[model samples]
Target: MAVALSTVAEAMLMDPALTAQIKPYEPWLLISGVFVLFILRRLTCRALRHRVDRIGYRLFGERGLLIWFWMNAPGVILHELCHACVVLLFRPFGFRITKITLFRIKPLVQERPYGMLQRGMPQALQLGEVQYVRPPGRLVSHIGDGLSAVAPLIGGIGAIIFLYWVATGYNIWEVRLQLIRPGWPWWTLLFAPYLILTITAELWPSSQDWRGARWLLTGLLLLAGIALATLWYTHVLVFNEALLQGVASVALHIDFALLALLILDLAIFIVADLLNRLL
Candidate 1:
């Protein structure tokens, strides 16, 4: 199985290689990284979020959700803005984003299962949402909708990278080389982690974003496969490594930034879980 499109879209862009040494394992390595990301997002991220929310709820009830939503304001705005921005770019192609909501004040009421019985829960609130209108069943709409659905992912990752640069003097290679910059200000790094938390938590596309995206993406994958096969057969296909490797490098960096967030989230989760149990 492939990585979820929204999570690691660039992994799918791996170009076919001509070299026996790097070609075979490059895609596999990228795929594995994506698989790990999916696992982390599904299990680790989910657990961390839920654990914190549990603590908040235990303390403040539904009001806790409101507070949590407000705390994640940066990410919420970025997420919705990503959708609206990308969708608006498709305006030339006949798509119009009808609404751009940064955040909402109301709680999301839904049913939950408890002992084979369902009960309504009002502990969840929507932080932000973007709504677009497009002609149904058109190829253009499908492509537009699919791209827009995953825009938050690209935006979130970009935000993380930017925050890291702002805090670390953008010394990416220094970090890689295990060299610490002397006399770095401690306060410069203060808000990056919290901002990253907000971004990652809100990055995943909501189920509503996938309403018209799955079919479009499936079709795209099929088309890409056919294109690769056809071009490979012609013997004139250019085996590009530089571009592919560059993209992979950037993606790896993005993943590492996210890994840092996961680490911090784990620490927070431990504290939240412990506090919840005691209180």
Candidate 2:
């Protein structure tokens, strides 16, 4: 399988035409796709929320705010759980769930917030936090921090893969093989659009998340640089081939998932607008 994937990667690298054809879609697997997903999810949340609030206010008056919070609680809980799980996995020492708050009003009262800031009056929002004992080393600490910050992304990727398997009754490797042979099941498409949107919406890392993960990124760059230098010096074709093949295979799978997410976001926007008009 590795050799076959390496051969495919090598063939694509050798063919300028193939590279050119695929180049335009590369952005969908990186930062651009993430940015678009965040924006779309935000917009969709706002739209659906408006509808929820409008109906709730009419029925429940001031309690509508609480209703809104609980309605969205499941996703928020899952997001926090992902972070906590990653921290526990890496730290191993111990961890604590610090807070799960529907409203953080202390900062509003103080006219200052420790983390994020908003200009308007106080509003209730769901947030979760976890605290864990850091490992006692520089390199290990950075890796742990990075993993904790990126747990949601890892969870999102797993969710997409799981959804694919559930839909097609085949694991990721089998699906990839089927895709290679142009024999992927059409039934998988039915569930994929929904799962892709769900995963992409939760995959984005916050500004705070990146701040905690800076050392991890630095460590990764250093390791990558070392690896490249070693490969260049040794001229190890096997290692290079294996690495390229692995990357290409993973990239192909993620690219498909992200493209589906993009399409789903568009559909959601259109549907949200239509629903708003009807409301």
Candidate 3:
């Protein structure tokens, strides 16, 4: 009965037009987001100092920093990207991979039927696979997460450099225009804070200092919700129809995707916590 309900719910959530609205520029946003994430990490380590060390130790033991860089960071990026890429590759018909934000405010992949109950069942079932990748074997399974996280960092830098090279050949005005042109949308700048907060929140070790980190994560989540609401109310209401239209178009699926990713992230954190306890 549960399986049947889950399958039926999944079928209802599939929408090709909605999916198409979500794709197109995800890779670029992902790459940019990664670069921003690495920068924030460096800043956080330098500024937070002892607090970070404590969090790291709590999450990953003696080699906390190494574990964070190699394990958690990568794991998160991959986890998010897996949703985006998988939808792109497999459910191309019903899925749209529209926009990928450097900020992890929302799910990497937004689908149709964004309602909680409507979205939750399908995601819970799909993410069941991640559970199997556990323990000793998990170290390897964790690799996907790590690589996914790191890929954007590497790709983003490469892209910026490539853009710089191309810009060099043009006139000064042209170069200026190019830098602030068709490629880099003005909206990206506006979204920077959310991206920074999201990445930092995600990659920061959340186990040993579970209480503190969890509190922080909870706060960030609240802030994200507020920001999304504000954006929807102001921009969608006053200035442009595009903002509301874009959001409305993807609203249903986004809810489902966010719920799924949150569950997966929680699972990873739980697994890491349990492993730490066992060891």
Candidate 4:
């Protein structure tokens, strides 16, 4: 096991592209970017709250209002599927999905509440819900729950990767960092913008999801701290050097992920305006 870990560490160290892309910035910036995208999604949705609700009401009044739910169903389904997939991955034989609520019987938040006091109210929404049985085991359960909780973000990662693959014919596993230039008509006008809005809007984790995974995040941080302390204490060993390099390489990849998310935010802003005009 030690030998295998050392070999894998050595491979991570040898990879330059992954480490070089974001040389000046810290890896934590990527984590912050993740949060920024979350806020941006909320703001974008809030801005469109009135228009979206208006469209839904106009197209299908109180009688058949589920049409709006159906319109956004693709994104909702994909988001929940990501959570389900992660649960299955960790649980294997034990996972069980209890239920999936495609639409709320009523809006999660009120539509168009006026006055400064009402501003505190959440924007109108038709969020879907998924419930499932968690697997047994403390550590395994924490990891599974954490990953499942952030499943929408995981889905966003997949969306960004799929967009990259479609635009540049590049494999994400290779850690390629080439951008699809803004001049690319097909990307700028269509797939890129659509994917950005679709993925970003679903990246918010519900409060229950966060509650389920809180300890899992704490445990990860503790483990990371230990790894850093060990690396500092073993600076003389070649294996330690490889481990440090591997960590840096992983940091760069995270930076890339964050950058992609930020770019998606920009795309969503533009698309949101276009949508407001059209719908």
Candidate 5:
């Protein structure tokens, strides 16, 4: 009943006049949705990590860190594999992945006064790491590094979609928020949340993943500027309606996906908050 109501509401919200008015701004809305979801997801991830750590520690000891790492193993694998796949795509361009570790606790290495190395102090807990060497030259470096770094963002979306389909036998929009159908297998209910929570927990890229992206973004902006200049000079500054609508469609679905994750994280956050305060 609730799902039916939501479906109707979704249709009502898609009034042609309102959509036409907002068509040009859909891209902006997508960007804003992604940014907002990023912030909220990070907070929830941190809280859940903290709660898991505390709970594990309370149950165990230093070994509790293992629980945390394993809990995020699925996410780590997806995130790092995404990076590796993109790096491999540029392999012909001289990119090579040297090492990939899903999770490790590494010591903080320091140079002694005599130039000797002192380590093994349990410095940092790495959820995942993908070490790769990029080709020389600025353009290739920028594009290769940026794409590899942000590959998880794109891959995560694809993965979420696939997992959703596996769980519901329908695309998210088709589900219309009706995740648990009347006559579905039990595995559907079991996988519906498990797979999604595991992956979306680490769907975002860290600050380190964004290193070379600034230069790439700068390059893109410059290219866009040049294209706009050429278009205006030729008096052909026209936006492609089909392309815009296509982008809008994808963005709307992505925003919907992110919104779903956001709500789930909110519920997890509330529960974690309660746990943190209590135990």
Candidate 6:
């Protein structure tokens, strides 16, 4: 039980994006989730947690396992759907929807004159060829790929903004931050990278050519580099002087960097994959 809790805590800490997201309200959520898990673990004879952990590992892979670092397509699709719905609500006629289909094709051949046949014969009929493609859409067509990337960032940023609004309204910034400080476990910071990655995905340009994909990848890398550099500089010049008051300061900076890189890498990979498939 101790080992399990430690492992879970470590995993959460390592994922800076997740950490950042939960950091603001860590004590309340973490304590509540843990207490709930504890009770449920007892009720189920610890079977449910084991089963979930096993399944999650199978789906998400063990930590630091590159092969397991696959994106959840359903999550991505829903994110895109949310964007589509929003667009339709505001500008219904501006967008069109299309469904993608996959099919198989066979080649056909025709007889030709001897001279023509000698050069090249007409294709003969065949039946086993297959092709997979996305269906056409106007609104989704233009933004499906892009929207998936953007939704998470919007969600994360929006959460932060909402928090700020609430804090200001109730004069809770100091109180809330203080309450959250102790339980701001490392894992919650992962949300930062998650947001960055999603936004980056939204910003990546789409193209059906290898060259274009290369350009997009290059641009993303450059942007990531710039963002990282800016963050580092700010940490040194501003955060160090203004905010780093305790031992947690170094950890905080490191957490921010990790989240940023994670986001950048995810964006680059998704855009590159899409470009490759199209090409």
Task: Name the candidate that leads on lDDT.
Answer: 5
* Winner by lDDT between candidate 4 and candidate 2: 4
Error of 2 at 35 (Å): 10
Instruction: List TM-scores for all candidates, in order.
Output: 0.70, 0.58, 0.23, 0.57, 0.70, 0.25
**Model 3 CA lDDT for position 68:** 36
> Which scores better on lDDT, 2 or 6?
2
- Model 2 Cα RMSD, 1 decimal: 9.7
Q: Candidate 3 on 54-128: residue-level lDDT in tens?
A: 466776776564333332343345334533443343232343444443222222133332101010111122110
In angstroms, give how far residue 162 of model 2 lies from its true place. 0.4
Tens digits of per-residue lDDT, candidate 6, 114-191, equal 111011101232211111122345434334333322333455344434443332332212223342345345454445
**Candidate 6 regions off by >4 Å?**
1-82, 85-95, 99-144, 160-177, 180-218, 223-279
Candidate 4 per-residue lDDT over residues 108-218, each given as its tens digit: 543321100010113344456556775456566667777777777778677767766666555444456455544554544455555555555555565656666677778
Candidate 3: Cα lDDT at 59: 68
| Between candidates 5 and 6, the lDDT winner | 5
Query: Given candidate 4, what's the lDDT at residue 171?
Result: 45
Ranking by lDDT: 5, 1, 4, 2, 3, 6
Model 3, TM vs. native:
0.23
lDDT agreement of model 2 with the native: 0.57
User: Which 10-residue window in model 4 sums to the lowest lDDT?
Assistant: 112-121
Give the range where candidate 2 is weakest over 10 consecutive residues by summed lDDT: 113-122
Query: Cα deviation in Å at residue 24, candidate 4?
Result: 8.5
lDDT, residue 91, candidate 6: 39
